[model samples]
Target chain A: GAGVSQSPSNKVTEKGKDVELRCDPISGHTALYWYRQRLGQGLEFLIYFQGNSAPDKSGLPSDRFSAERTGESVSTLTIQRTQQEDSAVYLCASSLARVPYNEQFFGPGTRLTVL
Target chain B: AQSVAQPEDQVNVAEGNPLTVKCTYSVSGNPYLFWYVQYPNRGLQFLLKYITGDNLVKGSYGFEAEFNKSQTSFHLKKPSALVSDSALYFCAVKRDDKIIFGKGTRLHILP
Candidate 1:
């Protein structure tokens, strides 16, 4: 079975430019999550979508960050007016939302570098 | 707030020796501890987890973790280290449907 996958493996963008990173979760995964990994830092939870419930946006760092998931399959993390501080690897993961303590399967990640 | 801590930024051990990467976490309810490994230029791979039952949880590649409730620690361990095991290790805790990961520890197995 295919694992989680992300598109635009690397992106170098100018400060203030908006970038959209895509993710494809494994088939039938009802729970999708986005995280940011700054260089030499831990994973920062961004947002999460579980089934039809409202998305959890509390972890989102700022207004510049937002995400959308079409149904339960694909998700996109968008950063508007990106800043140098936003440079990092954005990772996507998915799991069976109904199961307790289910392990998350991660995507290769999209590295974003802002100049 | 739920959070995790990896005290050591890096650890180096010779091959065939025991390896331990320490992690401690704080959560409101019963803790669900998990360990993950990330190779260079790769995504995170789930290692093992401690939801309940035995304190010693075995995982992939002969790795295991010990969940110490009193200490609030879940440290990854392997009896015999391998050079191939050199990578970034993360300790995470699941709470309220959100997972929190610690500042990962870099493990360097010197052969």
Candidate 2:
């Protein structure tokens, strides 16, 4: 089966510009997640969506970051007025369900560089 | 707040020798622990997880992790190390609806 896929493997943009990163979860995965990995740093939780429930937005660092999932399939993370600090690899993951025990499958990630 | 910690930033071990990457987590309620590996230029892959039951949980590529509730730790261990095992290992804990990841430990297997 195809793993999670992210669009635009790499993106370079001017500061203050808006960028949207897309993610396609596995065929039936109901739980999708977004994370940011700064250079030489660990994964930073961004947001999560599970089935039809409300998306968990607690991890979003600021109001400039937001995500939307059109069901259980595709998700798009958008950064408005990007800053140099927003430059990082944005990773997406998905699992079969929302259970804590289910292991997540990750995508190659989209590296966003804000100039 | 819930969080995960990897005390050592890097660990170097000789090939064929045992290796251990320490991870501890803090979260309310029963902890759901997991270990994931990221090879150079690749996405993160799930290694193993400790949900409940036995303390010793076996995972991919001959890797295993022991869940120590008393110590609030879930250390990833392998009896024998391989050069290919050299990569970034992240320890994570499921909190509420999201999984919080640690800073990651870089493993170097010296031949």
Best by lDDT: 2
The TM-scores of all predictions, comma-separated, are: 0.97, 0.98
The superposed Cα distance between candidate 2 and the true structure at residue B3, in angstroms, equals 1.9
lDDT of 1 by residue, A2-114 (tens): 99999999999999999999999999999999999999999999999999888999889999999999999899999999999999999999998732478999999999999
TM-score for predicted model 1 compared with the true structure: 0.97
lDDT of 2 by residue, B1-111 (tens): 648999999999999999999999999889999999999999999999999899999999999999999999999999999999999999999887788899999999999
Q: Superposing all C-alpha atoms, what RMSD in Å does each candidate have to the true structure?
A: 1.1, 0.9
List model 2 lDDT by residue over A92-114, tens digit each.
99999985868999999999999
Model 1, residue A13: what's the lDDT?
99
**Runs in model 1 lying further than 4 Å from the true structure:** A98-100
In model 2, the Cα lDDT at residue A114 comes to: 100
What is the C-alpha lDDT profile of model 1 across B1-111, one tens digit per residue?
548889999999999999999999988778898999999878999999999999999999999999998998999999999999999999999877788899899999998
